[model samples]
Target: YGAAEAGRDYNTTDMSRQRMYNEYLPPYKAAVEAGVGSVMSSFNDINGIPATANKWLMTDLLRKQWNFLGFVATDYTAINELSAHGLGDDKKVSELALNAGIDMDMVGEIFLRNLAQNIKEGTVKQADVDQACRRVLEAKYRLGLFQDPYHGVSEARAKQVLMQPAFVQAARDVARRSLVLLKNDNQTLPLKNTANIAVIGPLADRPLDMLGNWSGAGDAKQAVSILQGIKNVGGATIRVTYAHGANVTEDAQLIARLNEHGGQLDIDPRPADAQIAEAVAAAQKAEVVVAVVGESQGMTGEAASRADIGLPGRQLDLLKALKATGKPLVVVLC
Candidate 1:
């Protein structure tokens, strides 16, 4: 992505060719030379041109200059999205992408739909289409897909390996290692064995949410929600209480938009003040409070661009109420 924000897809990057050649192109050059099988054209523009439809990027730099032998695939409907970037409509994008040396489409079948007709109309060259086909075929050959289309397919193997004890332990270790400590004033962490803690937030007990956006074929019920996780780690050594602080948002528009993509963040039917009072009561009883709240997994990832990045809805209000409680507070932005 070139100078892109989550809110906007297209943005130009001002750069010098010297800096681009030296700083940016080396890793890609290395990957090509290392015989990587494929390259994915990103969903952002470079120098006011969308990468999927930029001939200089997909063809000139990647293939002619760098001599990359592998095929180039568009990043998820990026080819079809050229119009959104002010490039053109579907047929126009298909032609532009093909001419730019894009070999495969991810989900958007613009290439499949328009390439042959465009070639017949002399808008797209047959040679370009042939080259793209050849590159993709060569990649498949390298992967032995022709020899065995079912090479790695396994149903029983999945059950055998998924949630395996060793794998689970490894995942836990990785998660532990990945945690970044932002601030720990006065050594506030390493909670006292006898600490009374209140865990409050919409995400605190959301088991399904604990398993992020890409938990393929995995059961979210097995996921450890923040409240459960705190209890598990604290054990009988510490006392813990929980409250459903507030739903992710009260804004009807956001709720509607999220639900459009099956991003369901339930608007808690309970009155907002009542919810806050409950959370406040929990906070008042505890020596420390852990507030787990923020973007649901849906408010992130593709197509979920947020212009306002702060705590959405009345989340800040909840935080303010918690702050007034004056307990040692730990905020986890999930």
Candidate 2:
């Protein structure tokens, strides 16, 4: 149930929304072709209502039109999410969910809370309910859940799968390619061998923020942090220093949330003055100041953006201060 807006923000213009919709349809159609069994949409409300209750998305686009042979599940309580999106009251939201062909509602209390009234009001037709239930049953049948739900479990298979060389290689390739090179001025593409160098930044020494949203399957212990990567590339001797410098934001509430959810990238968002002082101190002492700054993981990704693009809090002040140190500043904006 992902929103149609592209480029990490939900305030997509009408023209941009149409373009994103066009881009989104083809991949979904391909997934159907690959014989997918079920589709669970996302948490963000798409357009007006959450994608879970959006009939236009599940029914019109995926089921009736694309002929997807899979049951559709909402991101989470899409019915309740409708209320949050300000689409309608609870009863109306439940009616919308069934009509939209959501086979199973997750966390949406409407199915349990107000279904009877929805059915009585002519707001939802019985046929729509039946269709959704039928789709769920079909999915269960295809999965052999009714026949033998536990058919595919085996210790031997699990061991063999883990040992598969191809899977290992694929994982390695994914890890390597996922790294985005932020700067390579004058073909400094591959880092040169230098005996003494400083890896300075709040984020440079940390690994947790590398994976953003929906990073459901990664092991923090298994991931290589930026600092770790540098150490592994032993061609050059490296000197590394980490400064938590400033928190990602100055807002106390925002910092508290980031502390819970953000990896290394998230920190105790501090006052602008604090951040600027730390950054300026570091810059004054360094030959090159690699100033990594931006919104924290919670600040600007999926459904996050600002009318003002300038750095939040006193971070911009920190940057200005760093520039005053006269060290070359190379910033990495996420």
Candidate 3:
């Protein structure tokens, strides 16, 4: 599919060729081996050459050495950022990237704006442009897009398959196996069905957070929150209580940026102390307390970073409060 700089958008990836081959290259190589239709160039430099304009990477390693036939597309605005990376101006960078082996310019109209003029000026060869276009067309042809652009996408089919029972069960099965149980003391393994359980945290009942970052076309409503999943498995016999112990963060700037696209942050307006008090109250009454806490949905994905990567806002306080309750504490990080 695509790659990122150090698995984060726009982050710097500085490493030796030996290290890249040993660690970073393997995944992309494997993807190439699997016949991925296209490879998106990362937003970082490879040995001081920005990936978008790195001929050695896109041409020598990816195409000639690895035998990757798919076209290379630039990550969002990556080609344009060559100027920011001190490579060149728009026209210069665009031509450089295209010659270097970038076949598609994603969200940056550098190619659209300058490639023709560059070709006329003999700055970029028409054959190189033709070659790039051929690769992209070949990928599209292989995907059967040329034959039927819609490719069987329909509202009826979407309704039939989206969150289908079989798919949901498969997801649940995968999720169950993916969980890593780091420790279990005093054989306090699975709780008895009769035990009272308190599921407390900002994320416990948050369906939106369950979908996670980059959940394309996946509806939050289709996701089963931790609270819902517990309730579903526990049935009517087991007691289950829930409390949102804290907002994901109280940072106004972060919240504003997070809400810019729409209010995905889900920052609770209640006072931090009030939220902590409620959680502590729930913990006091329950036989076992499950405190769900961690980075909010907006905190981990593209263009998002934290100077202090600990628990955000009063989540630490809520956790400390829950710990002091002396109830069996089960901490779940989102």
Candidate 4:
């Protein structure tokens, strides 16, 4: 229902129908079989047609063949992207999407602006539009939105649910179990309580980075940093040190793009060499070094992609320096 290339937003996915069914289509089919209320079309094209305007995918496969009873929605601004994908202008593509069996458009007003004109000009059938509207309305009715639009939403409820102790503990427990120990040479993990530990890298103390992408309504201030987690768990017996090794990236343009929502990147103003030197100093004092690294929260979500998806900026340099310190190293990726 979401994304086309392994859920990396706005990324392209090109594959044949056989490949789709063999791999990518199963999850969507499973969602349909599970009676998901609605399905959002992926941003990528299936075969040649955009998923939003692919009749074979949206209508033939999803509705007729798979028997998906739910309404189909387009991903954010996806209908508008049809023109960019060399399909057509807003008006033409909007009609194509509707005729293709898309019931709802997300964050693009193309349908609202052009559908009526399309109908009057005989370009779009009114019955098709009516059918799409009917499906959307039926979904709302099924969700009881017509009876109570404000169901389960209140300022009091928000306060009660957000960061509740039980919820936080449950989240922690799930995260603990999800961790995979890929390799552990010399039994390096489960560090001794007596050892001096140093936690380094920009992400080590970054609470906002811990919330990750698509963390809706979740406060960054309430999130705990890895450094804090280590300190909290290590207790009085264990010795711990911390230093931020480098900013996530030093590319001014990327930082500007990431901070468009206002300082989301959290770029440090310190010189990269100075940051790495501080981290090296910290590494020297500890028996073991835990280097926390990787993308900022903004680096992987919607509209964000990379030509080279390696460690950003001087992070790899910092890692190299930590390795040179001759201390046992643990790299924790965000």
TM-score of each: 0.90, 0.71, 0.90, 0.90
| Model 4 residue pairs with clashes | none
The candidate maximizing lDDT is 4
lDDT of the structure predicted as candidate 4: 0.87
Compose the digit string of candidate 3's lDDT tens values, residues 1-334: 1234446666566777787788777987898899888888877876677889999999999999999888889999889999999988999998889989999999999999999999999989999999999998998898899999999899999989877899999997998898887787765567765468999998898888887777777788778889998899889877899998998888989888778855476667889999899889988989898888987687887677676879988899899999999988888888
Point out the worst 10-residue segment of candidate 3 by lDDT.
Answer: 1-10
Give Cα-based local distance difference scores for all models: 0.83, 0.65, 0.85, 0.87
After TM-score superposition, the amount by which residue 162's alpha carbon in candidate 2 deviates from its true location, in angstroms, is 6.9
Which pairs of residues collide in candidate 3? none
lDDT per residue (tens digit) for residues 1-334 in model 1: 5436434644455456787788877888899999888999988777778888889988899889988888999999889889888777788888888888899998999988888889888999888888889988987888888999777778988888888999999998997798888998767686775479999998888777776766666576677888898989888888899988888888887788778866656677888888999999999999999999888777766555677889876778888999998888888877
Taking the candidates one at a time, how many backbone clashes does each contain?
Answer: 0, 5, 0, 0
lDDT of 1: 0.83
lDDT per residue, candidate 4, 202-233, as tens digits?
89988888888788877888889999999998
Residue 326 lDDT (model 3): 91
